[model samples]
Target: MSVRIGFIGVGGIAQSHLSGLLTLPEAEIVALCDISRQQVEKAVERFNKEAVGKEPAGRKLEAAIYDDYRQMLRREKLEAVFICLPPFVHGEVEEAVIEASLPFLVEKPVALSLSLAGKILDGVLKKELITTVGYQLRCGSFMDKARAALAGKTVAAIVANRFGRTPGVSWYHRQDKSGGQLVEQATHQVDMLRYLVGEVDTVYAAAATRINNKDNPEYDIFDSNCMTMTFACGAVGNFGNGTMAHVGVPPGLNGVHIFGDNVQVTIGGNLRIATPDGVTEEPLDKDMMVRQDSAFLKAVAENDPTLIRSDYLSGVRTLAVTLAGEKSARTGQPVKVADLLAAEAPAAL
Candidate 1:
C-alpha cells in the first residue's frame, strides 16, 4: 500500500527527505506546501526529474503546491506528511495534523517554545498518531554495530561535538528563530547521545558568539558552546559545539566518543571500537537518511508505532535538553530538564 505523502515545508531539509522518500516503492509524494511558492515550484521541478524512473505504475510525480498548510491538509487526500518547518514555526501545523489524525515525520529541533511543544504533544497523544523526528544521524549500520556492542554494558560517559560551519540560511543565523546551533544544528548529536547513552536529567553550559557574529552583523546566535550533562542512568556527558568552522574541519572530529567497561566506541567516519585487545573500524555501510525515511514510511504503512525508533515525545525530551542548555548558558547555572519541562508544559503534558 502506497503512502500518499504531503510535505509542509519544501526547504533544503525537506528536499533531502524527499530524496529518500522517492526511493521507497510505497511512497507517493502527492502534494507540497511551503510559504514560498517558488521554493515549492523548484521542488516540483526536481521531483519531476528525479522521480521519472522511480515512480510506480499509475502514479505520476504530480505534487500540487500550496502556501498555507491548512488548505493543503483540508484539500489533499494525504496519508502522511513531512513537517519540515523551522523551530519557531512548529505549533499550529502539527496540531492541525494531529487533529486530522494524519501521521507525520517532523524535523528537529521540534520547537523553540516548550509550552507549544507540550500542547502539540498532548494533541498527538490524544490522537494516538505515529510520528518520527528527523535525527537521521543514528540510522545506519555503523550505529547498529555500536548499539549491539553496548546492548548489556553500562555506558559511563560520552564526549560529543558538532564543530561545523554556520548554515547558509537567514533564519538560522538568529538565536530567537533557530535556537542557535545547539538547538538547531547540533540537536542531531544531542538526539544521538540520548539514543545511545540515556535520558539527560540536568545540564550546565557556557556559550558565546565568538567569531561568526563578527563576520555577519545579522548573526546573533552563539558560535561556541560547551555543556556538561548528567543522565538518568548516572552517566556523565560533555558536549562541545561551534558554528565557526571552515571547510578544513575533519568529519570524524565532529562525532561522538563513548566510554564504558573495557570498551571505547567512536562514531564518526565509521564505527571504531577498542576492547582491551585492539581497535577496529566499521564504515557507515548504508545511507542513513534513506533508512530513516524507510522506517517512518514502513511504520506508517503498517500502523505500528513499535517500528518507529524516535517518536514525538522523544523529540520533545531532546528539545528540552537543548533548550535547557540555552537557559543554562544564559543563567550560568545548572538547569534541570524536568523543571524546565514542568514550568513550560501544560498540565496535561
Candidate 2:
C-alpha cells in the first residue's frame, strides 16, 4: 500500500523533500529525474550507500535515474511526484502532471508569470488532481497558534521582513527566470498572510537590486523589495524581502511580525506568540519538509483534495498576489491581482 514517489529535479529543495520522504513508512522514493545526469547518478549512489543498514529485506532503496522527466513519467508506475524544478519551468511540468492524472507536490513561486500560472490552474482544475505547493510555514505550530490567537479580532496590520543571502544558483538571480525576491522567496509570506488573514485585493510595491551584481549581470531581479497590501477583508499588510543579510546569519534569522487587535506574534530565530494575557516562546521545529511530505502522502492515499492544504488552485492565487506585487514594483502603481491575471492571459505564454 506504499505510494511510489518520483522526484523531479535533484536540486537543494528536492534533496530536502527526498530526505523527508525517506522517513515516511507509507511512501518510498522509487525514481529520480534531473536534467543533469551526473547529479542523478550521484543521488542514486548516495541513496544506495545510505540504505545499507536501514532498508528492509527485498525493499532496499532502489531508484531509477532519468535525464528527462517525461520519460520517467511514461516509464514508471508513479503514484505521485515532487517537482523541485526552477520557477520558469514549473508551468509546463505541472500541465503534464495534470494531464497524467497523478497527484503532485510542486515547489513554490508556482509559476514565473501570472499568465502561465493561470494556465496551470486551468489545467489542474480540468484534471481534478490533488496537489500541494511548498509553502511549509503553514504547517508550523507557532503559525497555527498565531492564527488561532488572532481569530475573532480585527487585524490592524501585519509586518513581515525576510533578509537572507542569495541562493547559490545562477538562475535564482535573474528576474526573468525566478520572478525576483517577492515572487521567488517572499511568496511564502504572502501566502501566509492570506492564510492567517484573508485574500489580498491590491498591492503597491517598490524593488531594487542592491547586491550580487558581479556574479549576475542579468540580475535585474530585486535583491530587495517592500510591499503594501490591502486584503479583501479591508485589513492592511506591509512586507519587506531582501538578500541583504550577511552570510553569517542563520537561515531562520529572518523576521516576521503579525499584529492583531489583541495579539502580536513575532517569529524569527525562534517562535514567539504573544497576546495581552502572556507571551510564549516555542523553539521552531526545522522539519517542515518532512511534515509537508507526510501530509501530501496522506492526502494521496486517501484521494482527498481537501486534505492537501495548499492545492494547485490556492497556489495559483498566491502566485498571482506575488506576481501582482512584482508588476506593481515595475510600474510604480498599485496592481490588482485579478487585473494582472486578466492582462497577462495564457496567450502570452
> Cα lDDT for residue 305, model 2?
74
Each model's total of backbone clashes: 0, 0
Once model 1 is optimally superposed onto the true structure by TM-score, how far is the C-alpha of residue 272 displaced, in angstroms?
Answer: 0.9
lDDT of all predictions: 0.86, 0.80
In model 2, which runs have C-alpha deviations exceeding 4 angstroms? 54-60, 214-216, 247-253, 342-349
Q: What is the C-alpha RMSD of each candidate to the true structure, in Å?
A: 2.2, 3.0
Q: Write the per-residue lDDT of candidate 1 for residues 1-349, one digit (tens) a residue.
A: 7899999988999988777676677888888899999978877777677656655532345778899999999999999999999888888888889988999999998899788888888888888899999887777778778877777788899999889888877799988899899999888888888888878989999999878877578898999999999999888999999988875576578788999888888887678998888999967666788888888888999999998888888888888999999999999999999898888764322
The C-alpha local distance difference test score for the whole of candidate 1 amounts to 0.86
Clashing pairs in 2: none
Give the Cα-based TM-score of candidate 2 against the true structure.
0.92
Candidate with top TM-score is 1
